[model samples]
Target: MKKFIHEDFLLETDYAKELYHDYAKGQPIIDYHSHLPPNELAEDKNFENITQIWIEGDHYKWRAMRALGVPEKFITGKATDAEKFQKWAQTVPYTMRNPLYHWTHLELSRYFGIDELLTPESAEDIYAQCNSHLKKPSFSTRNLVSKMNVEVVCTTDDPLDNLSHHITLAESDCPVKVLPTFRPDGLINIEKVDFTDYISTLSKITGITITDLASLGEAAKKRVAYFHENGCRLSDHGLIHAYGYDYTEAEINKILSNRFAEKSISEKEIRQYKSAVLHLLGQLYAEKNWVMQLHLGPIRDTNKAILTKIGINAGVDSIGDYPQAEQLANFLNRLNNSGSLPKTILYNSNPSDNELFATMAGNFTGEEIKGKVQFGAAWWFLDQKDGIKDQLDAVSNMGLLSCSVGMLTDSRSFLSFPRHEYYRRVLCNILGNDLKDGLLPHDMKWIGKIVQDITYNNAKEFFQFPSLVENLSLKR
Candidate 1:
């Protein structure tokens, strides 16, 4: 048999086959950033059907459905599960060369052990077979996480969340460390769709009348404290740019006060106002030793009419054409130079910012830095093979390979855990090919150890989740 001919995972020789095959097999996954439901992790549900698990919240599938000329009744409306699955199956063949194409077949091959390509012809059998397995008890959320060797899964949570669910899940014996991150884009925005509603909710939660900018900041800090009490070690923000235009507290407070009085603020002034809040938040994060994640460069709520009906993040956000590097670099350096910078992990949506973020991650290291700075993996729109490979190459070429954490799915689909397997295989193949070409002295054991480290160890180490790895070693 030809080596790598029939193999789906990129192993190509006897030594290569033996070494990578066993190694690339599911090891513990450390998902650093994801949108998984905290309540579901707390409950750990078994799926009722493949369509329920895969189709329910998959915006990618929804996009494909939209492209396939599938009606909204079937795409995002009140269609039956069976109808939605049929629509998705019909659209699958048209997704050729798209990352979804590889990801779908890969899930089939990896999770279900089915080699047949999915198309309109084989859709029924494939769906039925997947649904059959979904009925089994082992297909539950907790079990599936355990199956994929996920040790730690950190989910995004709003600052206003009570996080009682996260505490309950963490206290359970499920062994997956499901942590919450503080995301406060709504709190920082004066232009958010439900800004008034959000402020009311925040006021109710913190018992502080947010009559002005100072009170607003105080209320947000009070809520952030509650999040920290529940073991939140990280905070996240999403923005079109890192607020670079500098301003004094008085100037920003004037902007906020005007905003509160329903006076229109200029786009330039709005950015400065947001920047002042971000700077203060950075100070707070540093004071508490919390990691800060900035997810930047996406133009949110693009389709105005669709946004009016469907709402934000319901598949309306698109990549912005803005240059992301300079402002982001300035934001970090502004904090760093002032000695108030927290350990930061930046996720950039613009593909052009890859090299810029690469150098940014390497900028602050060693004992001088209060804590480490990091480049987060390819995220959201860039969670595909080509995009991931680009990020890996940029980070490897510029920074220490050992410092780069492997991958995270950043997906809403329950079946997306197979993505860890996909990333690992690509990672191992890249390193393996490099060894074959005499790039790093042809040391298989050392290289294999590094490959394993990137896939599993690096993430845990980077996230400071060493207890789980100690437990995994005990299991071994």
Candidate 2:
């Protein structure tokens, strides 16, 4: 068998190796969506050890360790850092066939130069080596980002966020463009338990009294303007599915008033309110020429007991099976009819909706824009190799895969940058196999251009971030 993680790890053929190394590998990253904290990058924090950097805030690993019967303390509880690393080391070999196995080894090899398979036997030595490297200034958060050759990273932020850290990074001339993406899920999800508290937070941020739907709209408008002023050109939403309700302003106002007064609203009213807010936000995004991202189909916080112990983003969520196509089409059509549909990306956590989302995106292509509407890269549970192939096949069959802006980490870890590399390899292998199998012609130049675009070019062209470094390939 081939050596593990050699130069051509996932490349099964000569064509795949050529496409990856010569074209896809060197492309600078444009991480258009991620949950990386702006404050850490601003401060250039140096992680103390492997566990601190790898395990902390990484729910993927937590989920795997839990499956291996690793206890709460070693995963997310009050265990020593070394203890946590040990437990994860013990769990790594069991992750074979899971994307976690590849991701773990990739992170290790790329970041720490450790190519040996991780096991309980090698855990201590590997941990010590990574910790030694972590102590260096070159491994600081900013340097880590630079080392990965990432050109831009758009961090997810709330409407009420002050963006003070982003401002700090911008003023200091940090090379990587750490921009903000407006994520207003809490503001739109009025049925959430903390909806009133969130509204109060928004009111304080905007200095607006949000007693009615009009005032709430005013608050959101101000926040959107503020985000734009801070160099934000993207807005994101997480939804069970898209909503498109035709409700009068009076109805929305009543729903807002009821929620504000500690009164209950019906399920239908909740849908109406969410639809109204989404439409208004879509209009704002279009007016400002911002890219809107919709991350659909996640059923979050299913295990209430687990949530109480570890809180949100701690690996208790699963894919949702909500009806998507009709509402999604209506939502986009509403914006398109108003001549205010901005560039959009639709990401479905559930793989079964791949074709539905792909065709839905194809329906709204803009006259003046190339790939104005896109089926986003496979996300969350769908980021694995098989899932990547599924998404690519669907998009190629139903939409324009060439114009697609490619992968984003959608992660909270710095080491997760290798995920882009993983995607590039998978993409190159898929295209190369097609060539060898007589599916595609032997035109390497044309295929290489496509690989480069998906790896970096599409995102650079698609997003309108003000200070995005001129695309390096274009600069040549």
Candidate 3:
């Protein structure tokens, strides 16, 4: 048998190997979406050890360790960093057939030059070696980003954030362009307990009293402009599903007013309010030429006790089973009718919606742009091997795969850049396998260009990030 995760790992044929090594590997990453904290990059923070960087804030590993019967102490509790690393190494072998197994070794090899598999016996030496490297200036957050050949990073940010870190990076001669993405989930989900308080915070920031939907729209527009001034080119929304409920202006105004008055609104009213706000934001996105991303189908924080203790996004979330097609299509059509549909990307956390989303993406392609409306890469719970293949198949069957922009880490970890590499390998393998089976021609030059486009070029062209748009044109 072949060696584990060799240079041609996942590549089963000659075409696959060459496609990855020659065309896909050296391309710079445009990490258009991630949760990497800007302050860490701005301060150029260095981790104290492997666990600090790899274990902390990574819910993927937490979920796996929890599955292996690991206690909270070693996962996210008061254990020492070394203790956490030991627990993780012990859990690694059990992760075979899971994406984490590949990601773990890929990161170790790419970032730390460690080739041996992680296990309980090797944990101590590996931890010590990583800790020693962490102390070096080259391992600082900014340097780590540079080392990955990342061209741009768009960090998800709330509308109320001051974006001081983005400004700081812009002023420095930082190698990568670190920009902000406007994520207004708090503002959109008006039924949350913290909704009024979040609005109050936005009111304080914008000097606009958000007593009605109109004022809320005004406040959001102001923040959008602020984000644009700070070089933001994208906005993201996370929802159970897209909203399309129709509500009159008076009805929406009353909903917001009652919400601010500490009155209870029904679930239907909640959806109505959310739909109205999203449509308003879509108009703003179109006007500002910002790309809008919708991440749908998550039933979050299901374990109430764990949620009560560790809070949301503690890896207690699961895919939601929502009826996505009708509402999603309705929302897009509404935006299209109003000429307020910006360049859009739809991501489905539930695999059942993959074909639906891929088919729907074609219904809204803009005349001014190629692949103006896209089905985004597999996300969150669906970022694994089967999920990736399913999404690619759906998009290829129903949409323009050649014009599709590619993957993002969608992660909170710096080591997550290897995920992009993983996606590239999977993509090349799919294309190469077809060629080897006589389903595709052996036109290496054309196939190679398509791989490069998906790896880096499409995102560079799709987002038209100001820092790199000129370069994109030159490269083309």
Candidate 4:
């Protein structure tokens, strides 16, 4: 019997097969954004079992298990690792159409060399096999990343982080360049209850007094310089939507004073304050020549019961139908008008906003940069095959797909690098089908170069990380 995930998996035509195998398969991955723990990579930690690596902290699988009526003890509570693996195996058969089904099997096959379908019947042997593989010295975190041919990994970090682990990795003999991405969502989210506390933490870290917006911007600017000195070339922001409300400096300072005094501010004031902070940070990013990434449109933590019990990122966030266009344009235009619009990548969690994001990206594409404002890869709920294709179609139809920078994991798992491969296959299949239908000319070399650029070259150029450039030159 034919294996479900063969070499030509997801490649439906001969052109697709050739494109994937000949051009896309050999490219290195640049996971420019991920939630992977830098400490694990720095320590070269090895997992005790497959469940530790695969199931723990993987909310995607947890959501599926919950939908299948699996007990909380097995999902996230004190159930033994073996018991948790059993529950996940049982839930696998029911996840036929979900991306989890593909991701589970792909991770198993790629990492453990296990090709058998994950089901209750084959669960025990597969579990044992994965655990055995995890015990190998070659399965350490650093080794695992190197094995996947990853050139660079930019981990998400807060402005408050000292980046000791990144410093360690930089001074070590580790092959992959683990860089830090400056994420100031904590600083930008003034509406959170912990906003004052976060400001205190930032003030301590930067040795600045945060009495108002000016001091706060000064503290944040110091952090940006600190992060840049520590090898950061990117900044990330997670918001329901961009804040572009108009506010004078006095108004923002008053809003800050009220918030710091434990006074409740109106929604209008909240928007103005967030806009001011975001604009200040955007200027800092431009000054530092950093890439800015905005992950937008998700209404996070909707289930208050789950949120209260499990806290944030508890698999309760859903796509939001927020008004994105007007505010997003205003935010970008504000930065542009001030001559501080940095290279930006926009990721939309809602699939309905595909063209909206792609075209919005087009509106800010100048400044002698190729794809300066990218309509980033399909993100969150939209990382699957159909979503990937939809994003590609939107970019190709509304913008220049050839200039696209390609896929990212946006994941927390070290074993998720195969997503890049999955994306490549889907990309080749799309182009191949276009060729087959006579939509594209029958030119292999040019098309193949386009495939390679989207897979690797575009990102390499787009990010312009010093370590990546130095490493590529060394290879040459």
**TM-score against native, each model:** 0.90, 0.97, 0.97, 0.98
How much is the lDDT of residue 351 in candidate 1? 88
Candidate 1 deviant stretches above 4 angstroms: 1-8, 12-19, 22-26, 211-214, 366-371, 465-476
Over 4 Å off, model 3: 1-3, 468-476
Please give, for residues 1-476, the per-residue lDDT of candidate 4 as tens digits.
99888999999999999999999999999999999999999999999999999999899999999999998899988999999999999999999989999989889999999999999999999999999999998999999999999999999998888888988888778889999999988897788999999999988988899998899989999988888887789999999899888999999989989999999999999899989999999999999989999999999888899889888878888899998999999999999998999999999999989999999999986657999999999999999999999999999999999999999999888899999999999999999999999999999899999999999999999887875435321100
lDDT of 3 by residue, 1-476 (tens): 55476899888899999999999999999999999999999988999889999999998999999999999999989999889999999999999999999999999988988888899999999999888998999999988888899999999999989998888887776788898999999999888899989999999999998888788899999999999888889999999899998899999999888988999999999999989999999999999999999998999999999889898789999999989998999899999999899999999998988999999999988876989999999998788888898999999999889988999999889898989889988999999999999998999999999999988999988897886433211100
lDDT of each: 0.76, 0.91, 0.91, 0.92
Candidate 1 or 2, higher lDDT?
A: 2
> Which ten-residue region of model 4 has the weakest summed lDDT?
467-476
Best by lDDT: 4
Q: Please identify model 4 stretches exceeding 4 Å from their true place.
A: 469-476
TM-score of 4: 0.98
Model 1: per-residue lDDT, tens digit, 21-137? 767564678887788998887887877777888888788887777877888788778888877888888888899868788788877775677778788788889888998887787
What tens-digit string does per-residue lDDT give for candidate 2 at 29-70?
999999999999999999999898899999999999999899
**Model 4: pairs clashing at backbone N, Cα or C within 3 Å:** none
